[model samples]
Target: MKLKTALLASVLTSAAFAAQAQEVNVMSWGGSYAKSQVEAYHKPFTAEFGIKVNSIDADNPATPIKAQVEAGNVSVDVADVEFSDAVRLCDEGLLEPIDQSMLPAAPDGTPAADDFIEGALQDCAVANIVWSTVVSYNSKNVSGTPTTIADFFDTAKFPGKRGLRKSAKATLEMALMGDGVPAGEVYDMLDTDEGVDRAFAVLDRIKGDIVWWEAGAQPPQLLADGEVVMSTAYNGRIFNAAVAENQPLVVMWDGQILDFDLFVIPKGAPNLENAKKFIAFSTGTKPLADQASWISYGPARKSSGALVGLYSDGKTQMAPHMPTAAANLENALVNNFEFWVDKDAELNERFNAWLAN
Candidate 1:
């Protein structure tokens, strides 16, 4: 019942249950869902080690982490950062390199190092969570469930209340796809103003019907309340609602954004050694697979990618929450972390202005 500080070193100390009690600090996103999933990652981890887990969380974790590293008093040994935020911090030299040798072997003994999906893992950060914004439609109310982004925004066909995520990048990418852009061309098209405007123009046409959900889980909530017959929602939450509640909600993986969040070691973290141990352990098969069951977020570990205990049926797994559906995985537009990392302020400002207007 007592909430002990869950910090970075929590993973290694949690493992082995050895006599040496070391304290490590971890920084991560917090909410009941996020907190519970993160804490679950620590459970099997702590069982093997003798260290104590101290987890520190925040609403928006980037700026505080930057300050901590800049001040040269890095108490955060391991940090769970958003995909975009990780890129920004890495550019500022606040993140440390991940040493692959420390990681445990992949199940079945295939090497995990560099075996991850192409471009999914990076130098300073490794994939921790794989998520997607998917098309979800109420099966009970709507005659035919929508399966594509274009179908989600199609008013005449699937007419009802609709919702779209409020974020700039994911929305832009989805809009482009809705406008008929191919998955491969999404990044190239987004590199130009015309392409960007074209995507927004599609949204402008449906802005009135859209609920504009800012939080990831909002789509699923809206669907349940009947506020939206259909909307773009997080894959996990949508899948959970659909399978657990057997709601008529369904998803189309035709065009989705499979965004991955990562764990980065702050440059001056209080305990770099323990942090690495935690990361390696977290990305290991067991914890990664465990979080998948509790939360819909897919594990980053390539070895763990083969559909764990989340759900068995293909129909259920393809809901807006699960990223493992072959069709959806192929259609996903991975976020361009390099571009956004350097252009965060300018792009985000422009994005806000665009949204306001």
Candidate 2:
């Protein structure tokens, strides 16, 4: 009787441990982006490993990650963050370091280090997608086609309210580009006081016409509802609205700001090992390519490019729609994370002051 009781107690304890080990919490930017990750990464991961994934959303995952880590109550096992935030958070020691060797090799047996695109792997982050912030307009509302970046600033030509993100980062870059600063020269120009003034001066032209959006989901809704005719938006949101929901939206590739979204483990994640496993499985070549089918964002791995084909709708080809496509690259600007990492606080202070005035 004593031996049977001990055996029952041990079985119950082991079952509890197994149940606890089979779940992970992932935080990400909400809206269509989150949906894409759920479809491509989460569903497959859960099926393959028999682990439960809890999907959490925020306007920006970075904010909650910082808050949680600093408060010493980290709940998120993994988070999808922008390149600058990843670098900044890693530098501040708020994230766990990810070794490159843990990532899976390509299908052809090429190592992960060689398969990933340049700058995709970092000390504490592994990139999943290369997304872009582009200018998009509701076709039914706009007067004529606004092809160039400068057209976005010219109210006289477009003649409707513009939706601009309520942040200093992309807003300033687009303003400089609208004022005719070339893509390659944008960062160098923004590095100066005079250049900063120039960008703000251009923004002042359309200040009254601007409708500010802080979340990725807002831009598409703003355009669809005619709240704003033209908006600077994440390309994937625009694509989803246009293709999936059958909205009359058009993306202007010119002046698009390309950047990467990476997955990182918080400093003290409750399921650290499971988080690492999720990252490895999700970032593999097939999974990366699978994400592109759900959204127009390019895969971070070079090996995944060839595998990216039609969209989920079964007809739309994805390559030409990608931000990295040759045609789209004509006047595109790759985001300078280093510049933003150093200048984000100072510029945002000035931007807030300007907003008040």
Candidate 3:
């Protein structure tokens, strides 16, 4: 009787341990961005909760979320996606609506909704970082420094192959800015047919000199290989290239398109409860601020800003490198999520037709 009782107790303890060892699969853009999350979120979350997190990479995490939800075979538990994708996916009923109340308040007790930046928290998502797509050039390859957006289109002046993301979103906005449209009016201008033509007209000047890139990692590599002298890249990637790799790359912040990357859970996530816990914990003040140490992207919470200091190198100051930094914001365009949510498909179709032409 004593032996049987001991055996039963051991089996129950084993079952409880197995149950407590839940894991979440998180998908994000690979490279420095992924590394930042691993240090700031994944490792800490596991340490705190004993929940294992599986890190996965995709060129764009949003693409797979839609497929997984629609097919009813969701594998991803939590995903890092862009503002527009998060909004669109939520609208299409593909994502689980996040309860903002579950998010931890600021250290001083400010509510999560009040602590996060305006537009950072959405119905189905919570933002993590404010990143920008900006132009970067190899200082060693360029003849003169580029101080403005127009310089990106000036092949005759700068004279080298240019690298651009093969997407219409940032490409159109950057073109308009290069054509001298004010950052505030970029989306307003693109809303008109003539304005779009003007953007394409700007693109026409450098069409022959453009080398297109599709992945986040490609732009930095393109600059390093001298495949293109100037490229529009995620600010963090260029920072890593210059600060981490000791490359001659210089980021031109004049025409940057700033946007947010948010955390969201899919509607049919296998581990919904754990997924929510991960989002709430990872997006808390300290973790969000901790992420800044690994990448140049700005944290979404205003409170996190004060905590941001040096880069992982411990010497490179993160402030000047952030897209939200005062000096850098002078000419930066905030990505119009509503405009993109409505027009992304239409613009991309037109963009693809133009690309093939």
Candidate 4:
């Protein structure tokens, strides 16, 4: 009887530890982007820490984090989100404040805060990559090559349905850029109601032929299906479709809107310690560099830039494909997270009304 009781107790203790060793759930935008994280972060993390990572997808990771936190049913340990959304959520007390001191410094001994690009670090989030939303078109579908942001709206020159994200953030910036608003002045113009009207006026020119897309994957699929001759897409998606899948898609860097994607721990994550460990490891110089080989997005850390090289295909260089590449930066506009954080509700309301009309 004593032996049997001891055996049962041991069995129960082992089972509890096994259950506690299960995977940490991470939520992110799906498609090739998620695959990049899986290869660069998840697999290595599991091997190193013995804790598995279960990646989940959403249309926008930020949206679900908010819902889960407010309902007090938080499940996601970490999320990859845009700069503006990260800022907005952190402000609303939905995110766990990250301690920058815990971040690993650069190889050269520069602190993480200084090694990261300006605006890459936030109070509650740490940026991982600097990506862009740029104009892309199927070369096979277009009559002539379109070279500029203005060409995206010039239906008379490159006529076909346009694919645009169903959001005000990138879409409004692109609309204003198409209307000949210089990159430097985009935010200033957007600050005024009349400027917002001007942006809508630009969209009105192409609204009749617009096919709205809500997912990052949809833009590439839309172009592939001959539904849209030209679309605005995250640079990494177009790079994957063009390089990996052999699609005849061309990306126009002109008027690209550059922004950061950050890692944030939701306020009440079940595995808070492991989540922080994952963020630190994933955003470190080596892993960030490894991710660049899988996708075209530039790493947020200055130290990681030197380590980036050819794509996973082993032929194409990743630098020129990056949003921060000198050629790509000519007319690029860095997304103003502060502006978005302040005006998101107001602008989105107007945008929805405009879409309804």
Candidate 5:
């Protein structure tokens, strides 16, 4: 009887240890953005559920997710990806469909679907923040202030290397805007070969003076080091550099491209259930708002806006810094995800060819 009792106790102890060892791997764009998620989501989540979270970083999390899913050796459980990548991966059957029922309601009992901003809740992903890619300049590097998208291409006036993302997505949109295409007509214009040529024509004018950056963190570094007078960068990165680090970086919202970063689960994720739980918890009202305090990106939930009051420093008000603020939205272009979902490959190929020549 004593031996049997001891055996049962040992089995239960092993089970508890096994449960404690369970963890979910999350991938995100590195730098301050990933740090924000760690403070706002990962720490609180591990404390609550006793589940460990392995935080990872990449230039673009979506790339590794697709590779891992296709290779059938899935390691990452959750990833932060752009809206277009989420839709494209889902359509490709590379991601698991996320059921909306798993999400928590708002504090006032509003359903998740109703609480999230339009297009925030996707069939296979849940958005966490609304961020933008904007032109930023070092105050000490230039003589006059650049106020418009056209100014970004006017190297004769600015007269320094310009920083641009190496990708075709936002680069093309901004190029068109620089050439005088209205924000509303950018996608419609890009649908044709003539518009494509026009955007490249603008890029050609400054191609000799352009420095291409591939990572989110590189743009601010490029600007601060004076490698480029002005660079297209993620707004939150510029905000952190200018506000937190006391750098002279400035964000120009005139031709900003707004988009969402969402949480998605790759198909065959090793910790599927934990990934779902993490998504539900991290995208909840408070967590979403808490992330905003650490960075200038706006939360995706309508209810979260009221909770976002100050920067983590406690002195800086966050509203005016957000990409969605009224003043910033005057000439802003919300990214057309559907257009990118269809044209990504074709346009990127063209962009790469242009870079080569």
Candidate 6:
């Protein structure tokens, strides 16, 4: 279940070097998941296209991506952009707008431009997978279990220390839900200033009991090590961590925040064509399912959805973030990245200021 970067690099070098090293640089959020995608899918792709891919880690960083693009030092030919960042990149003229004819098209003749799942399309990028920041509790520590964000925040209802992510985008949406907003209304609420403040107010109630985690990796690790009894976590990270020990953790789809990872080309990318090819190839169902098997991502490919139907033991074979698994949740969140992208600047500032307080 643990992703080994060294081993993956060795395998990829052998496989890809034997094929293509014409070399295109990709700035993705490098880590186990990104590595696996490279070693598994990208390596084979290079073999076919004779194009080498250099993956650089451009994880959710402190500085804005627009700054990097503006500086003309755009190091990434292909980037694994967050939808929110992609929007900002597009607005700033820091993204290479994709041409549908140049990319893969769906069976119905719609180009890859429209192949993305509903609520996932944007002006600058394509969502590659879906995930959630949801209630994950160590079964070993708690009496029963928390079923939703409300339960996680309900200290009197379920007494224990809880974990919340440090980001404002998803956190604010979760807060809005806790404040009694319906899952579907989250984006609509964020469209108004009053709703944003109202969501923050909801967070203030449980702020004392909540410990903050900054990345997808932290919350699951904390859960596995018994650091926090219960907290919110990326569905895949927690599920992947559980592969070894079968940790007593669960993701309640109820009011769960829908999140995703996207792929984009930075402004002034040299290998724009190659980047498009890589994206189209990687986004196909089988490669996506390859990620789903070990990585626990909710595949964005329509074919990945069809492919999952072939697996019988959905619980045993799929992680909670999988479309099959998430289908069972009572409540689910739909993240409107377009909204976050537009508001990330102001929202992130206020979020940081609030966290500091």
| Best model number under TM-score | 2
How would you encode candidate 6's per-residue C-alpha lDDT over 1-357 as one tens digit per residue? 246887888899998765543667766655556755785568878898888788676546324346667888765677776667777777778788865455566556655656667755666676777766677888887767676667766778877777888888778888888777888888889889999889888888888888888766778778777777787777767766666346677666667776777777777776666788887777765677666665666777665665542222244666444633636456777678768767888998988888889
Pairs that collide in candidate 5 are: none
Candidate 3 — number of clashing residue pairs? Answer: 0
> What would the TM-score be for candidate 1 when compared with the true structure?
0.80
lDDT of 2 at 10: 97
Q: How does model 3 score by TM-score? A: 0.95
Q: Which ranges in model 2 have alpha carbons more than 4 Å from their true place?
A: 1-10
What lDDT tens digits, residue by residue, belong to model 5 across residues 1-357? 999999999999999878855899999998999999999999999999988999999999999999999999999999999999999999999999999999999999999999999999999999999999999999999769999989999998879999999999999999999999999999999999999999999999999999999999999999889999999999999999999999999899999999999999999998899999999999999999999999999999999999999899989999999999999999999999999999999999999999998
Arrange candidates by TM-score, descending.
Answer: 2, 4, 5, 3, 6, 1
Residue 110, model 4: Cα distance from true site in angstroms: 2.0
Judge candidate 6 at residue 104 and give its lDDT.
61
Relative to the unseen true structure, what is the C-alpha lDDT of residue 272 in candidate 3, on a scale of 0 to 100?
A: 92
**What is the full ranking by lDDT, best candidate first?**
2, 5, 4, 3, 1, 6
Collision count of model 2: 0
Per-residue CA lDDT of model 3 for 1-357, tens digit only, reads: 999999999999999877754999999999999999999999999999999999999999999989999999999999999999999999999999999999999998999899999999999999999999999999988998899999999988899999999999999999999988999898889999999889888988888899999889999999999999999999999999899999999999999999999999998998899999999999999999999999999999988999999998889889998999899988989999999999999999988888888
> lDDT value for candidate 5?
0.96
> How displaced is residue 100 in candidate 2, in Å?
0.4
Mark the regions of model 4 whose C-alpha exceeds 4 Å error after superposition: 2-7, 10-18
lDDT by residue (tens digit), candidate 4, 183-203: 999999999989999999999
- What's the true lDDT of residue 118 in model 1? 61
Query: Compared to the true structure, candidate 4 yields what TM-score?
Result: 0.97
Candidate 2, residues 151-192: lDDT per residue as tens digits?
A: 999999889999999999999999999999999999999999
Better structure of 4 and 6 per TM-score: 4
